[model samples]
Target chain A: MKKIINEPGKFVDEMVQGILLAHPGALRTVGDDLRILARADAPVSGKVGIVTGGGSGHLPLFKGYVGPGLCSAVAIGNVFSSPSSQQVFEATKAVDGGAGVLYLYGNYGGDVLNFDLACDLAELEDIETRTVLGRDDVASQPRERADDRRGVAGIFFAYKAAGAAAERGDSLDEVARIAEDVVVNTATMGIGISPTILPTTGKASFDLPDGEMEIGIGIHGEPGIHRGPLETADQIADRLVGAIIDDLSLADGDRVAVLVNGLGATPLEELYVLYRRVDEVLRGRGVEIERTYVGEYATSLEMAGASVSVLRLDDARLELLNAPAQSPFFREVSA
Target chain B: MRTADLNVVARRALADLVGYADELRDLDQALGDGDLGVTISLGAGAVIEALEQLPEDATAAELAKACAKAFANANPSTMAALVAGGLLAGSKTLVDSTEPNQADAARFVRAAGDNIALRGKTQLGDKTILDAIMPAADALEAGSDPVAALDAAVVGAERAVADTKALQSRRGRASWLQERSIGLQDPGATAFLRLLQCWQAALHAAPAERN
Candidate 1:
């Protein structure tokens, strides 16, 4: 309930305005309605444009990923709500190069329906569009129904692979293929120690009793698989990483990329603590950690929790993962 | 009713939706992100404004299209988009018809329900708006008079809304709750019922008011 804002209704508008001001050189609003955010150098003639969008509250997600070597544009929506089909269509028009546009986003119903409608509209305008859904949250659904799983922090991998492919002037088909590959190879699981408060409602999205934690919790405060008394940090790490690892069926000598993502309020120190245990567990299983990311890559307002995402990697995915990319929230400085 | 009468009905339906904003928000808070009320209210307000500006001679399809566009522009929520999609699908069925009857209404409802299911990738038992809308469409298709058809539709939707309490969510935000989502009425289904009830009220009131 205690946060800095003038009006709950205008929160998204004010926040987007601030983002534009803060990153004038890198980002700009597209269309008369100003609902789509495109990179300053969008529509880079021959490259396949990459677009992603979702609800607003998850900062540094759809919008933060809009920049060079990442997403070309993002359709902005209200907090925890999908962007309208018209807004998504505007994003498609703003980012369409001759090669076509790739829609990479989570597999939420609203997002899917709206984006699909936008695609139909875009096709009428002679712009080709392809979609790759992210369903990497292992906790949302069982492996047999993986397509029903929610897209969580692991979407970062899809963004990286697809963006890198497009940056290298790959065809739209190749970019979408690479993005889907990342989705298929990645698995994410999270645990929540507390719930986040919705800005407008000024109430917790859900309640978690003090001194307890919920495993397999979704970023939107969706119910998790199990809830019990809080356990040790290592135990929590084991549960999260263990779930992902088991889902991926990773074996010895397998190389992987690790993402220890904080769900907004969790601190870097705590994320590292979880990462240390994750690294130890993976090493014990002889899984090679090719790269690791530890930060708030994806968030749920100020929810206090973290998620562990593991992407089973091959040489192609590893190369894409290491490729140079720059965005306001994420960056991989070429080494 | 003619297209002009449809506009009045549309305006009344939107007003009724705005009135239910708080109730819908409370229902959504139980399992959803708790923004459905505000989002739908904003969409309904925009549609009302659009209805006021619509040309007197606008056709049935034109009116439906305007409502869809207005709703899409005002809010980007899931439920709003689904409603917009339904409107668009329903509008397609009303093309070439200046005056719509009970049969046209039945076709519109059926098309809208089908579009929502196809776009949402959900089925009848998914505990979504389709639960209410699908049965309402079937009831409308079976009835004769427009008012009577709408009455049946409302009854069907009311039953669907009650039935949602026993179902598990398979789509949208509530899907995240898993088994915990049971026992709570699906907010989207409840909203669908409210829309049907509002439309039926407007239809029944129009004749009396005109007389």
Candidate 2:
């Protein structure tokens, strides 16, 4: 029930205003409604545009990924809600260069509907678009039903690959293919020991006993697969990395990138603690760790937990991952 | 029917359908945020005014487009925008037609229904507005006479609304309720049914239909 804010209703708008004010050169509002934001120098002539969005409260998630060599635009919505189709269309229109646009976003019901509607609207304006959903949360659905799994931290890998492809002037179809490939190779699983308090309600997003943790937790506090007494850091890492390994079927000599992400309230030291165990488990299995990123890449407000995302790397994906990229919340300098 | 008179038919039907706005609001209250009634009432009023301003020689496609623009501008709700987009997509099937016949009515309704399904990421049994629309579209295409087609459409849509009562919602806010949403009449499906019945009544009273 305790938090810092001016008004609950103004939380999203104020946060967006702060971001716009803080990163004026890197971003610009696309539409008059203030719901859509695009790269400051968008419509890079002949480069395919990549538009990614979802609900708010997952800051540095949707809106934070808009800049050079990342998402070209974003349509932001309320906390844990889908943006309107018009907002999405506005973003598409603002960023579309001569090449077509790609809709890279999470797999959720409302977002899917709104984006598809925007695609239809974009067609009316002669702006071609392709879509690739981030369905990498292996805990939400089985590997066989990956298409239906909810997107989680693993989407960062997709954004990186797709954005780099677009910057290199890949055809719209090629960019889309690359995004879909990254999604296929990625898998994420999270655990939640604490829940977030929504700004409006000032109440918990979910309830759990004090000494227990929820495994396979969604960012929005959607019920995880199981609830059990809190385990040691190594055990937690084993559960998360173990599930990802089985899902992606990593074998000896397989190259992969690891992301140990904090779910809002967790600290950097704790993330590194988790990463320590992650490194041991992967190396023990003879998996070659090509890259390692540990931080709060995506978050669920003030929820206290972390997730692990593994992207099996090939030469092309590794190249995309290393390409020069910059966003407000993420960046990748030249090799 | 004369394409020029399409606006009049639409305006009259919309005005009549406004009578059920309160019922729609009540139904939506049980499932969603309860703005369906307000969206429809405001949208119908806006469309009525917009149709009044259309030129006497306006084509049916233009009329449909006007309805789409007016309805979308009437409210900021995602539902209104989606329905408006559906109307715009349906208008494409009328590309160069001067008059809209019974067949055109079937085509328009079915095209709109298909767009709503695809745009809404749903199918015939998703417990959204499409549940009522596709059944009505099928009936319209099956019937030979306009009057009979509308009658059959009404019956099909009514049956669909009743049948959907036992199914859980699969889209939009109602889906969040999971199994608890079952047994409630979907406000969206009901709204489409109301529109069909109003159109049927308006057509029956039209002087052009009599001729």
Candidate 3:
């Protein structure tokens, strides 16, 4: 309701404009309609294109991941809405380097439908396309129906692995297989301490009383599995890490990458506090931390919450995760 | 009714949709992201604007195609995409008809509902828009007069909207709420009901002889 914007209707467009302006050297708008964001040097000849897309409210996600070692392009949509199939096709066309393209994205229904439609369109143009859906949010569905789970911050791991593989000139099937493997090995759980207001409606998507926390809520403020009084940072970390570890069946001496992602409004200091607990919990369980990302990697629009994602890592995944990548939002130092 | 009349009816339905946008937003806020109202209105506005550029004598299929493109382009939300897919599918049923009658209207509604179900992968009891749209399509199929059929469809949709309060969502964002989504009207279903009511009202407001 109270935020910085010229017009609620133009929020997504203006945001895209700002992002392009801020990252002029790294990103550019593509497509006939200019609805897609691609890496400045997209269409890398012979390299398999990696593309992802979703609704707009989540920052540093579909768009922010478009770069040298991340997604080659992203089809952008309105806030909390999927991009049109035409837009997706444009992104596919913009990134296709003749080998093929892989569509990596969350498992939301809208994204699924639009991306599937785009694949069909791309087929008409003789461009091969494969899809790998990210379903790593443990809270959306039970483990038995893991395919139905929503993709949260855990998708960041998939992006890294797939992007690195593609950047190394891996074939589309190989890149997609690697991405799917990452999706299967990753699990994420989030806790919402407060609700966010939709910009257009200027109303809270949902209500959370002053002193309550909802564990397992999605980025859109969907109701979580459990709602109760707010707990301490350690307790919150225990619940999130405990759920993810249980779902993943992580054993002692296992190696994993941890990402403590802030949901837009949470402060970095608070995220680090949560990450500290996550580190302590993993250490106590004998799980080796291969790498750690504690920051606002993916975000909802000003939602006060955080999510913890753990990627069970093997040597190949670790190698890819450590590969050099640079985007405006995500960066991995060359090792 | 004449094929030209379809454009007028679509315009009226869009106006009603734009008018009820805020109400739909409030309903969605209870169970899902509160963007349905704006998304639907934006889609409708695009359709209406596109309709303005169409020839006065355009066939029902052409009109429906324009609406399909407009809705899909203006709003890419799940609900909007489903609606756009439905319109595209329904247009196929009217392709051969120069002036579709009540029977064609019935078939259009049924085809639209079936396409939405297929495209969205949702069924009657999924607590989605299909809950209202499927029943309304059936009701429309049972009647011969356009006005009466629309009236029947509206009643059926209204009942389905109320019925959704007792059902749990199994599709789209509302499904995330699980049991908590119970007792809240499915926003997509409510919007479908409003659309039917708007169409019925448009049918009634027109001259009776043409219908």
Number of the top-ranking candidate, with lDDT as the measure: 2
Q: Write model 3 residue lDDT over A186-253, tens digit each, in one string.
A: 99999998888888999998989999999999988888899999999999999999999999999899
lDDT of each: 0.87, 0.90, 0.87
TM-score for every candidate vs. truth?
A: 0.69, 0.85, 0.67
Worst 10 residues of 2 chain A by lDDT: A117-126
**Ten contiguous residues minimizing lDDT sum, candidate 2 chain B:** B202-211
True C-alpha contacts between chains kept, each model in order = 0.16, 0.34, 0.06
Off by over 4 Å in 2: B1-38, B41-70, B88-101, B118-128, B154-211
Error of 2 at A126 (Å): 3.2
List A-chain TM-scores for all predictions.
0.99, 0.99, 0.99
Of the pair 2 and 3, which is ahead by TM-score? 2
Instruction: Quote the positional error of residue B82 for candidate 2 in Å.
Output: 2.9
Evaluate candidate 2 and give its CAPRI docking class based on DockQ.
acceptable
lDDT of 3 at B187: 89
Residue A71 displacement (Å), model 3: 0.3
Q: Over the stretch B118-154, how does candidate 2's per-residue lDDT look in tens digits?
A: 7777887778999999999899899989888989999
